[model samples]
Target chain A: AQSVTQLDSHVSVSEGTPVLLRCNYSSSYSPSLFWYVQHPNKGLQLLLKYTSAATLVKGINGFEAEFKKSETSFHLTKPSAHMSDAAEYFCVVSAFGGNRDDKIIFGKGTRLHILP
Target chain B: GAGVSQSPRYKVAKRGQDVALRCDPISGHVSLFWYQQALGQGPEFLTYFQNEAQLDKSGLPSDRFFAERPEGSVSTLKIQRTQQEDSAVYLCASSSPREWGQPQHFGDGTRLSIL
Candidate 1:
């Protein structure tokens, strides 16, 4: 049984400011983690993923997440926030690092709000 | 052909009505998934299909919920009797066979409202 937890239901930041959305996971096996962004009335877009590779992962739009084994965390970050960055973000844990298990679990979500 | 496409972006139904939702996965994609998302919540897996084989249906809420991918290309989810609790966005996603870690591409989703 794998699961994900998003620390914040919502996070607000000013334009040009750095952003952080925290996530944690629990898996019996090595996990495959992912970040997805969903805009209003739009489909989800992949941000990044970590599958027992490099701890630091870079994604589109300058977004990135670091997989911390000690902390059981994969937190998304950005150096500067843009208005287009306002969207709902999800952290997911795919069972067994995706080689065998395709079952995925999602967090409730973190709604990012960019203030002008 | 550009991406996964779902029919009728929105649907409204009365109690006891049967509704069917369609999903067209990416050309030659091997895996397809169906999920239901409530307001302000992440999508919940309902079922999965590998080609035309329905591999997993464990997440389905009840027997009233059913899904099928007959020709290994298109799939359908049918709700036998609409209920207020069924009012939510139904999302469809598909992934290819290149990598196990490949993220699934999603459709905009169909917002089903039961009245």
Candidate 2:
């Protein structure tokens, strides 16, 4: 019953401009949220994770996402976009159904296009 | 070598042919997962294994899709009677058992193409 929705299917931004990718989730339990990036023909790389520790979580490569409980949103952001930032971004949610059921649900994904 | 590894980076077969994909998890990872990713779509869960126990296989699309983690380390996903709909990138990921909220490490994936 847990699901994640990415607001945009594609986002275009100029180099040196700020970037934003919006995501929302519906979960019955306190969720563990994550952001992952995948390049063409490459595996998905974890960006950041929120495990009930901090609302604001920082990730690799100058990326960050904030977990808003009231709004049920975990949107990813970057201070400035770079040419290398072009990739597919996914928002994930895990219900934490004990140790046996750690399956994570993924959003449809938003493709980021950085223009030079 | 340090991350999850999947074999046969690309596979092409006839519609009726059977294909097998392999995955080798990290040295000590206790949880392994298989996912199917169609073009322009997010990965969908297929099955999961905790050590050698196949705990969940509910996400499997049909009986033709089967997966197993035999020795708690190596896993294989076999698709019998492959069809055009089964052509997708099959991804394998592993995570540690120590924490329920741990992030998963992924493989580059095996791209299966059914002709």
Tell me the TM-score of each prediction against the true structure: 0.97, 0.98
User: What TM-score does the A-chain of candidate 1 achieve?
Assistant: 0.96
**Tens digit of lDDT per residue, candidate 2, span A1-116?**
68999999999999999999999999877899999999999999999999999899999999999999989999999999999999999999988765434889999999999999
lDDT string for model 1 (A3-38, tens) is 899999999999999999999999988888999999
Candidate 2 TM-score to native: 0.98
lDDT of 1 by residue, B14-81 (tens): 98999999999899899999999998899999999999999889989999999999999999999998
> CA lDDT of B82 in candidate 1?
85
What lDDT does the true structure give each of the candidates?
Answer: 0.92, 0.94
Correct interface contacts retained, every candidate:
0.72, 0.72
